[model samples]
Target: MTSSLSWRLAFCFTLWLSQPLSLQAQETLADWRDVPVAQLEQGAQNGVADAQYALGLRLEKGRGLLQNFALAATWFTRAADQGHAAAQHRLGQYYFDGIGVETNAQAALNWLRKAAQAGDATYLYDLARVLETQPEGKPLAADLYQQAADLGHQEAAVSLAVLYQNGTGVAQDFARALQLYEGPAAAGQARAQNNLGLLYVRGNGVQQDYVRAAALFQAAADQGLALAMGNLATMYENGFGVPLDEALAVELHQLAARKNSAKTGNLHPGWVFDTRLAPPDSSAEALERLRQGVTRGDPLAGFLLGWHHLQKTETSQEEFRQAARLLRSSAEAGYPPAMANLGLMYFEGRALPQDYVLGYMWLVLAASAGQPEAPELAVVLSARMTQSQLVEAQELAVIKGGDQLANR
Candidate 1:
C-alpha cells in the first residue's frame, strides 16, 4: 500500500499523467497536407471530420494559422461528434488540461472512453490513468492497465506492477510485480527501474541486494528522476550499497531538489545538507559543518556555503568574492546549480566580469545537466547577446561536454 500510494503521488504531475499531444499525427491526418486554408476551412464547414481534425491541429499548433485553443477545441468537438478517434482523444486532452474549455474530469473521462472503444492501447492507458484517480474506478483501472500492458504499453506495465506490488484492487504478488518491471526497466523506463529498485531494497521476492538496488537507482537518477536521485543519495550517505561520500550525497540531494522544484517552475528551491538521521541543532552548527566539508574539498559543500552567504541580507564585498570563488569551484566540478548560479553572477557582473558568452555557456551546461530553468533563462539572456556571442557560447557548451538528455 505504501509503495502504491508513493507511486501515484510521485507521478501526480509526471509519469505522463497529462500526456502531451503528439506533434506528428497519423498519415490519415496528413490528407490536407498542402491544402490551402480556405479549402480546408470549406471542407471543415462541409462537415468533413478529417478536415476538421486537420484544421484543429493547425489551429492548435499555429502551423499555418493563428494559435487558438478555443477554436481548436471547437473543431475537435465537431470531428469528435462524427466519431473520429483522434479527435476524441484530443478533445479529452483539452478537457483534461483545461486548454480551451473549463477543466472537467468527467467529460475528459467520457471522451477518453469513447476514444478507447476501438481497443487502442494508448487510448486505454490514457483512460486508465484518469480512472485511477477515482476511488470507485480502481478495479476497472487495473483491468484497463493490464489490457494496455499486454498490448505493449510500457507505462501501463509499470502502473500495473504497482498494483500487484501493493495489492491495490489485485492480489499482492511481488513475483508478478518483478515480472512486469523487468522488461520496462531493461528498456530504460526510469519509473520501472526506480520501483524495481524499491522492491530489491525491501527484498520483496528476491534476496536483498543493495548493490543491485543502488545500480537501479543510479540508472533512474541519471535520467533525472527526483525520487531515484533521493534514493541514491540515501545509499551514498549511509554507505548502504556504495562507499560513503558525504559530498556526493549532498550534491545528489540538491540535484533531486532542483529537479523536483524545476517541474513546478521554482527558480531557487531550498535544500538541506543533513544526511544524518539526526541533524545539528542550529543554523550556525550547520554552517560549521558545511565549512568543515568545504575544507575537505567537498564541492557541493562549497557551493552550499557560497549560496548561504549570498542569501544574507547584508553581505560584504569580501563575502561576494568568497561566494564567487566557491561557486566557480563547484561549477567547474560540474554541479548544475553551481553552474547556473555562477552563470547568473557572471551575467549580472556580481563579483565577476560581465561576459555574456561565458554566462550563456554555463547556462547551457546546466540545462544539459537537467536544470530546467537554465535553457529558458539562457534564451532570455541571449536576447542581450550578439549572434556571434550566441554561436560562441553554444560551441563552448558542446566543447565542455554537455550531456545529451534522453526525451522523456
Candidate 2:
C-alpha cells in the first residue's frame, strides 16, 4: 500500500479502536455495506460512466471487496473514454502515482488536460501541478491555475498567487499575489493563509500589519502548515502581534522543524522534466543521473554535483579538490551558484590559496547572473579589497580571460 493509504488506514483503525468495543466490527463492516459490488459491476458493464467511476473507486479502495488497482484502472479508463471528467482525473492521477498504471507523466498530462477541458476545477488544479514541473510549462500552468481560481478553487488560487509572488512565468506582482491569496486565505487554504501573512510582515502589496500577519499565521499553523508555525513563533518571540514568549516560540519552531519538507514555490532547472521520467529514488541512481546530465554538458548538474560533494560531512581532501574542480567547470559554463560557491571557497583558502581578487571577481560575475547569495558575499568580500584590487577584480570579472585563470 502507498504511505497515504497506510496513514489513512491507521487513522481509521485508531478511530475504530477508540469507539465502544462492541460496535467496532459492526461500524467497520457498515462503512463498506453501502457500496454494493455486484450492482456496481453490472452498471459498469452497461457502460454507465458514473457507475463505472464509482465501481472503480470501490475496487481501488477495497470497499466490500479485495483491492484491485488493475481492474480499477480499467474501469476508470472506460468511464474516462465516456467523457467522465472525474474518472479522467482519477485515471491520470493513478498513472502519475504508478498505482495501477506505469508512471507516465505524459499520459498523466494528456488525461489531466482532457479533464481540465471538461470544466472541472479540481482536475484543472491537478494538471497545473504536473505542468509546473515542466520546462516552459509554467506559463500554461499559470493560465490553468487562473481558470481554476476563477471557478473558486481555493488551492488553485493559492498556487496562482505563488507564481505571481515569485515571478515564475509571470510578472512579479505582489499586489496581485496578495489579491489572489485573500480569497483562498479566507476560504481556509493553509498555504495561501501563510503566504498572505508573509506579505503582511514584509509590507508587500499591503500595509504592514503585524497583528493581521500573526492572525493569518495562526490560522495556517492550526491547519498544520509548518512554515506558518515558524512565522507565528517569530511573532511570539518578537512581540510583534503576540506576547513575547520565548518558550512558546521554541515549541512552535520545533513543530515546524518536524514537518521535514514542504511545497515552496521556487522552481529550479532540475524540475524541468519534459521527458516524462520519475525522479531517481536512491543516492547512486541520483548520482548516475547527474553524471548523465553532466555528460550532456548540463552546467546545472555539474553545479549540483559540486555542491553535493562539498556538503558531505566526512569529505576527504581529494573530494574537496574534486568539488572545487567540478565547481570550476560549472562556473566556466556560467552556472551562478557554482561561481558563488567557488568564489567563497577561494576566498576562504579551501583547496587553494586565498585569492581575494579572483574571489571578488567570481562573486561579482555570480551577482550579475542573479545568484541569490552572491551579492551579500560580494559586499562583504569587496570591503576587504584595496581600491586597486577592486579595480583589478572588476576588470578581470568582465573580461573573457578564458584560459588564463585555468592555466594558472
Query: Considering every candidate listed, which one attains the maximal TM-score?
Result: 1
All candidates: CA RMSD in angstroms?
15.7, 21.2
Q: In terms of lDDT, which candidate is strongest?
A: 1
Worst 10 residues of 2 by lDDT: 5-14
Those runs of model 1 whose alpha carbons end farther than 4 Å from true positions after fitting are 1-9, 13-25, 33-39, 268-408
Q: Estimate each model's TM-score.
A: 0.62, 0.54
> What is the lDDT for 350 in model 1?
74
Judged by whole-model lDDT over C-alpha atoms, candidate 1 comes out at 0.77
Q: What is the lDDT of residue 241 in candidate 2?
A: 74
What residue pairs clash in candidate 1, if any at all?
none
Poorly placed runs, candidate 2 (over 4 Å): 1-35, 257-408
Q: Write the per-residue lDDT of candidate 1 for residues 1-408, one digit (tens) a residue.
A: 012212222665342212544333365477886799899999999999989999987665444453355778899999999998888988987787676677799899999999988777878888888888877887898999999999889999999998888888888999999999999999999999999998888889878898999999999999999999988888888787788787898999899998876665344323222233243233988989988988898887888888887777888888888989988887777777788888888777778898888887787677666665665676455556654575566567666643422311
Candidate 2 lDDT by residue in tens digits, 70-178: 6778998999898877778778877775656677889988888988786667678778988887799999999999998888778788888888988998999999999
